[model samples]
Target chain A: MALDMKLFKDVKTIAHAGMDGLIFYFSGEPVQANQRVQQYMLSINHAKPDWLKTLIPSYDSLLVCFDCFKVDAHFVYQYLAAHELTHAVSIDGSHHQIPVWYDSPQANDFEQIKNQTGLDKSEVIKLHTSYSLQVFAVGFAPGFAYMGELPEELVCPRLATPRKKVPQGAVAIAEKQAAIYPFSSPGGWNLLGLCPWYYELTDPGDLPEFSVGDSVSFYAINEKQFTEMANDR
Target chain B: MTDKLPIGFVIEDPGLCAIIVDNGRDSGLDRGFSEGGPLDETAYFWSNWLCGNAEGEPAIECIGSIAFTVKARAAIAVTGPDVTLTRNGNACPSWQTLNVEPGDKVTAKSLSPTAKVYLAMSGKWLLNEVMGSAGTMMREGTGGLDGKGKPLDSGDCIPIRIGDADKKEVPNWLQPDYHSNEPLDVVPGYQFEHFYPLARRRFFSADYTVTSDINRMGYRLNGPAVTSDVQNMRSEGINMGAIQFPQDGQPIIMLRDRQTLGGYPKIGCVAPYDIPRLVQQQVDGVVQFNECAASDARTKWLLAKSKRVRYLTEK
Candidate 1:
């Protein structure tokens, strides 16, 4: 059955208020529905009016924030209603390999996960790298993006206690979601690997490089390459 | 271009961290930037009024005491809780402007009580505006004089535009009370209904005490366990005054530097006007939450803000 876009009109209206924004609730299975929502938002973004700033897709719904001083909530509601939305669908995806060094002595949870999942280090790396992932949303810290649906074997709950600071470029996992830490900060996700990609600051002039519907892959590199990339920047 | 004269003095020492702040950055949270500015808005406004600056103009947020040597004559005012001013070693009044000679040594004493203080001068300070605010957010390392979130330190010379040096007296009516003890008004959030009904009842009826764990990021409250059986929640965008009840069941009121979004269930948000009351709350201070209708709350908020503007403009 196709998804009904009309069901979200009230939520979209409240979200347009630009004050304390609204959160829309969608009833569906978690993993499949979350991906569908992302695809739906991408279509909405493509058809969005020039006046709209951005439409963000979350796990279940879309968040739309506008400049209240310029446009009111009613106009936003009308705009969403007029646009016919495509049924959410996951597109055929491409994978970008992330070179990870799980061999570091500081790999705190490395041995623990190996113990729990009964998979050798090489098998673990193969499982993580082999799958193609989608960038679900950018949230939490600045430039921090949540991408997901890890293999069922790799899905694990977050650490009971979060570390005070997770280093920048650290690739971590929580439940079914895999993410890369854009900046060094405290987090609860299990550390698995690291990446060297930088999320550019939001400049009013520049287009966002990654959006909800885009595909992302991770490639692991050696310590020497990591140091070189760090210095080059 | 005319050379602008630097005006102002630090009478009473600014002890540790102090910086000029106005309204903070409107965006940048998506990139994980924290909004840094005066922790106490009410005091910040009063400080601006004392210096003869209009509302929204830059005012010095003295985390401790600020002492400065005046290079040019200018009128300045000190406001906020528990701050004492001394000019050339003599005590001075707060919420009122004082004219000083170019060589006067102005000193601000450590807040005997409150955590922050505000000092505003008659003319605007010379600082680059970054992300549309003069406020500083040191965590993301942006905004402030150099746009680096560095606070005012000793030996740092701040330049100020010179206005009428002769204008010294602050009208009696213009002086704000600076002391307001009232319960903060919160508008219930949409998720208010999600929590167990009994927990919601207990939340409204209980009095929470402010813990010492307070900063620009959040205020962790210690009170009756404001719990809910709901543990897991998808992360979502959070507002300025959101009252988040983490799994620990202790309610934490998020402030300016709070994460852009949160997963914890929020009971509601304290009204903007009542934010000052939260900022002024001291460790162990007990405060009760009162519900306000959204429409009435917004109207009262606008009126209060307008009054603050008028007070700043009064001669």
Candidate 2:
């Protein structure tokens, strides 16, 4: 895992997230860009930059919060250019297979999504399960992992008017991204189905299930399996 | 029943958005938990101070018209906007510590011209943390005593550690001036240059009104609809006080419970020190933004934090 510190040399854009925070923008697809951000963070972690506070990696950006009292933004930029610290730690590569209960009654907007995409219920679910999509980013709510690049066939606009409450574990899609609702919240994404027993992954020996680089694939399951898995959970 | 028996306050009424909150300090964002803390830091700290509780201790933040019946004597501090606080039909002064006797019903109504009020008890409200925080994040359905994101309802008894009879007051020098018309300090954001020069100038000079749709997550500022030339920016990591520009061009100040990432163009972030004032601003209240250098903002922020620490530790 070799990383070139020079890859960050262009540094074309830096946005102030807050007085103490700065967002360094990158140009690439979600998977590559997010991995680069993680690598960048790992490099910084190894360097142990004194001014660093927190590192938040998003789709195409790496947000850095610093101790404003100790060092300003100018110093960060200067330090990065002056120092030659480029080391990459091996990123865990694993795809979490999640069983989804598609086209269930709780999936309120499946019919609407089908009509919008001109795809039947089974076709839509097949298209969704076909791709091994990466966990691009997770935000909007806790454990809400935004997986990406839904097959063009599955690409559809979000609900014109969002639902008041999209239930927890809801598998949803809008534009190019799909996600599972960690908790019930007001949302606009087209509800596909619920992930059976998907939650705060208790798996040990590694990070949580939805780290930025980890991939995900959904498998269609019947309502009976959904109920059984949920009960087991 | 004896006076020595430890008794708690019974929630006779859990008025608008009344819920238990603490410092809610968190480092669990990697695990998908946002730091959910008080909306108004000045009020939260002051309430804790006057009630003899350390910073970040648990307390009740009442939005409007909260009533509680005390089962035992307790020292309470009602802080925040100029809300009307009453105990047993008698008017009481706020921004300082007050006493609650057994069977006494304490109530707090609106600030009318104000925003929220903090009812801090001398005893610490005890609740099991769901994800390193005690603040009730209703949207996420996690946190608080119930662990179900349920709002405080009538007949709920807030659990707290019983305290001694001695009560403390916030020194006059330490008392904060919650009301001020000074310009809010906003550090320029990354997309600041995306705005037209004229629009940027107007954003700094124009008066923005605080909209009624304010909450712990964010505040909608109603003023000039300043648009950015950049149309489709990718979502990035968002922090507290990031000012976002939507298609409507109106600015929204993101706060404590704000989403971790957002796609909107940001004009700038309102300075952290000024956020307490910004969040407590009443609906339609006029506010003006003043842009400052990031270095200056940090210096001021450190000074403010140090001042609070000095006061707390000195006496």
Candidate 3:
């Protein structure tokens, strides 16, 4: 039992996550960090090996919530030594082409983003619609997805003071993450556009096509298109 | 009165934080919705049991004068901290089932030392289900009278399933004496053994007062500053009742509406049965946390659950 833990000493660090949870930390590169955690999460979900219950993946760590009565610390140590993080990216991962009304009247953040970053309206829009980002994690608010590690050139800071209420469907970016206001709630992210498609994309499931580990790309659309999608929901 | 599977209750007042809730949206956790049920489950179940309603039935929870008028005679129960309950123009005691006549006014409020209260109707509330829950996930904008997580507003009519026309109060109203100084059962989690021995000792020996800062999300405790050498712990799913140590050394007991992922290092989880009594503690109330094994906690929970089921079924 002692030697099993010694074999994987440098690869990962295992610790108690909670009464029924175990935390596994991996010192992996940024590119494969989330996937590595997801791989571990999938194993617990798919196999429930050793009485595993549920798995939550974050940056480079995976928190495994399990049935404590069914397994012990020895079981976790052996499991960690036996299984390794996989390299297989999900083939079923989806890409959503979200339409946006950038810097429109309601958004009114184009000038804000421009002044803060010294980038003009078109430049901001170009950078925002530049490429799709993956949903790294979902939290803070229900249906709120954290899409992240925005392109370095486009990274922005949070507002000086958060608004009392950021209307739903408002697209914003802050630090290294971008998120859409799922419900009309207070937030500090710097607004860049309004997707106006929240109802269309946020029902049936917490997020329509915005599952974690999936990718999303934005496309510039006229106000008319935005209104149409807004009404579509 | 029209015959319907769901009985209707018209709202005359929508108190602060009033919403339709049940056991919670536990299944919806993976789908990005937090499990937002009642903060006081023991009180919630007591209300349901008094009204002969089964488990997982929807009910109203609030902190103010949540008044309503019924279109038909109905049996209902309210439970929680002391509240000024009025049936029509007559004052009434809570914690037991009471029958109300058509047009009878029902209201519950606590002006001083306010705490949450649960009102369980004889029939479950009828509402559009989101992920199979009528309980409102306020942050998610789903579930409730309207499909948008809004609370019962003035003039709102809630549909409910009608049941046994005869109404009888429970044999005895449980006015359990909950001593704030009593130790809250804590289930030792994975990180329990890692906490400093002295810190663990202080946590058990000392009494932590519930701070004024509280909500459906969690209750913040102010007491012995518990510090851990590790900072910036990775975020993960925080089960209801987990005592989390945030950046500041204070421990916050995550409740039903807690965020899906939290970064604070949690020392342990409160036993599920203890959460009911924990939620009833008023602001500045003193509470002591005691460590117990998860196995013991689970066994106790199962036994209590079975006892409640048997009691309700036989009744």
Q: Name the candidate that leads on lDDT.
A: 2
Where in model 1 is the C-alpha error above 4 Å?
A: A1-7, A10-20, A25-99, A103-127, A151-163, A196-211, B1-14, B30-32, B110-114, B164-181, B229-232, B306-315
Residue B313 accuracy (lDDT) in model 1: 58
Which residue pairs in candidate 3 collide?
A: A18-B189, A18-B190, A19-B189, A19-B190, B5-B161, B6-B160, B6-B161, B7-B160
Better of 2 and 3 by TM-score: 2
lDDT of 3 by residue, B185-226 (tens): 887663555568898888878989988877777888899987
As for lDDT, the candidate ahead, 1 or 2, is 2
lDDT of 3: 0.70
Which 10 successive residues of model 1 chain B have the least lDDT summed? Answer: B1-10
**For model 3, how does the per-residue alpha-carbon lDDT over A62-89 read when each residue is reduced to its tens digit?**
6666665577555766887787655356
Clash-forming residue pairs, model 2: A15-B190, A16-B190
- Per-residue lDDT of A18 in model 3: 41
In the range B143-237, model 2's lDDT, one tens digit per residue, is 76576667888887777776753556665555445578999999887688888999999999999998886778788888888987865355567
Deviation (Å) of B153 in candidate 1: 2.2
Question: A-chain TM-score in candidate 1?
Answer: 0.64
Off by over 4 Å in 2: A1-12, A27-29, A43-53, A69-71, A75-92, A97-129, A150-164, A188-208, A219-233, B1-8, B164-179, B205-207, B306-315
The sequence of per-residue lDDT tens digits that candidate 2 reaches over residues A1-233 is: 01122435534467666788877776666666666676677688778877886676777777788877788777776666565648653557688888888757887576787787889888888898889887777777777787887887888765544465787788888777778876666666788888766533332112235877778888988888887887776
Each prediction's TM-score against the native?
Answer: 0.77, 0.82, 0.73
Ranking by DockQ: 2, 3, 1
- Score chain A of each prediction against the true chain A by TM-score and list the results: 0.64, 0.79, 0.73
- Least well predicted 10-residue stretch by lDDT in candidate 1 chain A: A9-18
- Evaluate residue B222 in candidate 3 and report its C-alpha lDDT on the 0 to 100 scale: 95
